[model samples]
Target: MGKQMFSKPPIQKSHELLLPTTKESCWILVFLLAFGVSSIHGDDGKIDFRYHHYLDLSRVLNDTAASCHEISRVYSVGKSVEGRDLWVIEFSDNPGVHEPGEPEFRYVGNMHGNEAVGREILVYLVQYLCSGYQAGDARIRRLIDQTRIHIMPSMNPDGFERAATLGPDSPRTSTSWGSYGRLNSERIDLNRNFPDMLPVWLLQEESQRRNHHVEIPEWYWDTLVAPETLSVILWSLSQPFVLAGSLHGGSVVVSYPFDSCGLRKVMRSYSEAPDDALFRKLAKVYVDGHRKMGKCGQVEPCNARNFTCKGGMTNGAEWYCVPGGMQDFSYLVTNCLEMTFELSCDKYPGEDELQTYWEDNKEALLSYMEAVHTGIKGFVRDGSGKGVANATISVEGVDHDVTTGELNIFDIKTYFLIPQRLTETTGDCSFRGLTG
Candidate 1:
């Protein structure tokens, strides 16, 4: 006999307590139950899960790691102001500490509290890669062997918890600092708090009353001097790995280079310094990938004519003219290639679409990752076989990776452009480029 499909509910009407079973009926019930539970868990009228529910995610990651010991490990990068551990899960096939010379990659999610899906995507990717790789999945194994993936699931744990605990339908008008969800308890926009690349002076009585000692908001002052941003800066500066992508949401877009205003000025001139072609190439890859995913948005250059620069605050690294943005900073300061990937649409899509987004982005992300592993090395040469001077080269694409162990921010490589000057000659000038 085939398996029975329907079991009577505990409470039934007197008229009909018994019913015939059917396989289709059983399948329907199972589907409904699964869908209902997922919807409930992903409730609050948004596809994103509540931030405090990260504990459940942690458990899921732990279970997957235990089952597939070689491909994944859960670790902490730091602690939030609220003292919650900033969890980072490393996914790679290489089971030991990466040798000094090995390539690495970093993928960070949830830098902002409201953009929570990245954490889910990171977790899902880890599980998928581990399971897929163990099954002799060619693509998975290749990615694992070639690159190391360092994923920070939640950069702003405090903000995430606050947003989630507040519920999705909560009033947008809430005035609490946490309700705004951009800053910590101290109300500093981490993105804006970086050292200002171009500082504007505000002349006030305090400005005229300079003193050796002054009382100020300690948290504000301390954050202005915080070592956290500096630590990430130092870490990325010390590595030679390929690409890094800082993931965000609210719009499906991939942004590249010179996020701060001064850098834009430097890049505007044809002779002084031009835009990097490598960045353009990567942007193309991202745009193509998104288009393939049915998301038809162009990859916008960071320094486009219409790009916004005014009112932009620089981080510490940016202020010292350090190009200290996570992506631009990695590229300009360290010469490591990086891009800011804004994942998903402006209004949050439903949870049902999450898997689809991942699938669509897989190839583009993988291609970019591969580009980083094999450094995109090239030389611009003139017609006379001599190197071209002041010629800019940019390469852009989806960035992905696998890591050996403890994927440190410092370990990821930056995309670099080595400009060499060619002596002036009489022959008609032409240029050439190459990548490994």
Candidate 2:
């Protein structure tokens, strides 16, 4: 709530099956579709930019781990409606352990099955990180050494299978591209399937409106939420995420929370969060890092939409109301600061265009990850030198506050650092995993 400044930096499951059958046998079709079926790497050692089957995705992640075993590991968060594993590849110096004072960052792609760009681009990112670190890229090494990065390339795999057409050679017309793969196997829109908290926020008094870590209602558990949504909820809560990016498609802009404006669905008014300035800065980080996004209407995707923002950034609700969006949920229910990156005008682009997209967004992705290191972080300890648990870390005049200890959905706890400008008057900064 105050602008004060400082210098510098720091930082599973099993299910059984209902396989969808196409005109071609799934296995044979997938193999033929993958251009070079044996390897994902090209002659120059860069990943081939193309659409990949779920099996191909798994292989890419595992192969990366095997090749870069010292700094990476592959794991599954849960299963989808059609029994596909939601795989996550984590990059850290200590791989599986949560290092003290090290922030956890995540990039979740393809929440919508038709939004294939985010999914494939993330695979490119995985390859870039592992290869860059192995090649002794100083910036990449610094990121891997100081921060823990988790990337789930495709969150809705079942929908992706439905959306991705025959192979790289198959024709994708305008009619077929955007319509088929937007939802999950249950026909649920994963983006809108999370619990909505707009009503809850409206009910709270003005002073209590900016409250963080709002609990999920018990009734939410009994609803018809998609399995994919539930999987992400559990995964997001189980870790201490400092910053997150939800990659999407259909337009090119960066959107920050609060995404919904209670009941007034049709109105295009801004719903400013308590940390609005901080959120705007985060969105600008991506916009400025990209080649064309910051130019706004001058770029291809931006011009297509006729969108005009100073830096191709807009508040989520102002752009258009999106209730139950993951971007809003990440901030409301957890300590994570999340934003949505709409990467292209085409939701599902041709395989030929994947390489261009990777080049366009690569810098922005790395810069955003590096941002997790710019904030303040420390522990909340008592006079006895033991860390204090369930403690609230409040800043004067800032409505939103972070808590210390562990993180979980039912009773969530924050990990580290408020990125905003702070002074001594704004007391109480705390961290996670520091108990004696």
Candidate 3:
């Protein structure tokens, strides 16, 4: 089949609020998007949902980018330990361009290379988004028109190759005790290699402890960091990502932030964040949309690993203390509300089951993408109507605040757009001095 041109979809009606501004200070005009979640259909049996090698995945992304040039494009964030590109395929009305007021969302899969289910599902999701938009699927059209969706199908290509070499049915790789090919080429657990805030928080006085938008610690450089971890960290800090999902396997549940706990070495402790309620809501969106995962806040059978989660959602720390996890890094170090989705109990499921897994997760994936637009998003501009740089925006009651400014980490400079006032739907917001 040849490429098809997709006509632009009409913009949906957005509720715009224009607050008065002064010449000396910048004002923020916040608007809310009409929240609508719907199932996406249009499985044309064209794009195959199979386990892809790094080269094959690259080609798939490239081909999709060419076919869906109007709404999708491919780019690489960085390389893995073994020099594999950490490619990201983005879908939007205007591909590769950042549109003001549009929230950016991302899904990162195969962080643990052995957990191949998410990587394959994400690849399927890429094809679905592109095909759905081209096929005039209304829900998908809305998603592409309103939000920038970035999907990195594989974050640990080196480990993935290792796992694929062992084959899915290999007893050594399939065993619960053995975590073959789970680490990157450097043999470091990427999830646990990020700068841990638990250590920093414990050392700080209660009054001095910073929870939200936490900075990377200086001593973190003294330790060995995985290339994949650094790449993701730098990539995240460089953007104004509003929402994200880290896909994993070996469990079937949705878990939200504070993956690490203040209580040292605690196996089961609830380390809740200030935006705990909002995080729970975000996590529940996926769970409720999932076909098997029952409604959030209610006990449901997962049917895998004999696991049952109340509402198929859990607080990350309560599930298990994972120090330096990506979920926590996203919430604390960047303007991204991240959740970890344990998509399947089988980490390296057979490729033949990819389509079934995709069918089970398609709605949940799309619904979560739609949820990004459910929050307040707008622009911080000066009296001249130009975006004000280095503006710190905060809600009256929310403990966390987002900044619009330049951040220099590991000597790499990152400039971020003004993030959404991620707080209550109805609340007063305050902005700090314009440093632009």
Q: Top model by lDDT, which number?
A: 2
* Local accuracy by lDDT, each model: 0.45, 0.72, 0.71
By summed lDDT, the worst window of 10 consecutive residues in model 2 runs over 26-35
Number of clashes recorded per candidate: 34, 2, 1
Clashes of 3: 1
lDDT of 3 by residue, 363-415 (tens): 89989988876745554545454555544555444566555542222322222
Which residue pairs in candidate 2 have backbone atoms (N, alpha carbon, C) closer than 3 angstroms, thus clashing?
Answer: 11-146, 12-76
Task: Sort by TM-score, best first.
Answer: 2, 3, 1
Off by over 4 Å in 3: 1-36, 170-179, 198-205, 209-211, 295-309, 383-386, 406-436
Give the TM-score (vs. native) of candidate 1. 0.59
Decoy 2 TM-score against native? 0.83
TM-score of each: 0.59, 0.83, 0.82
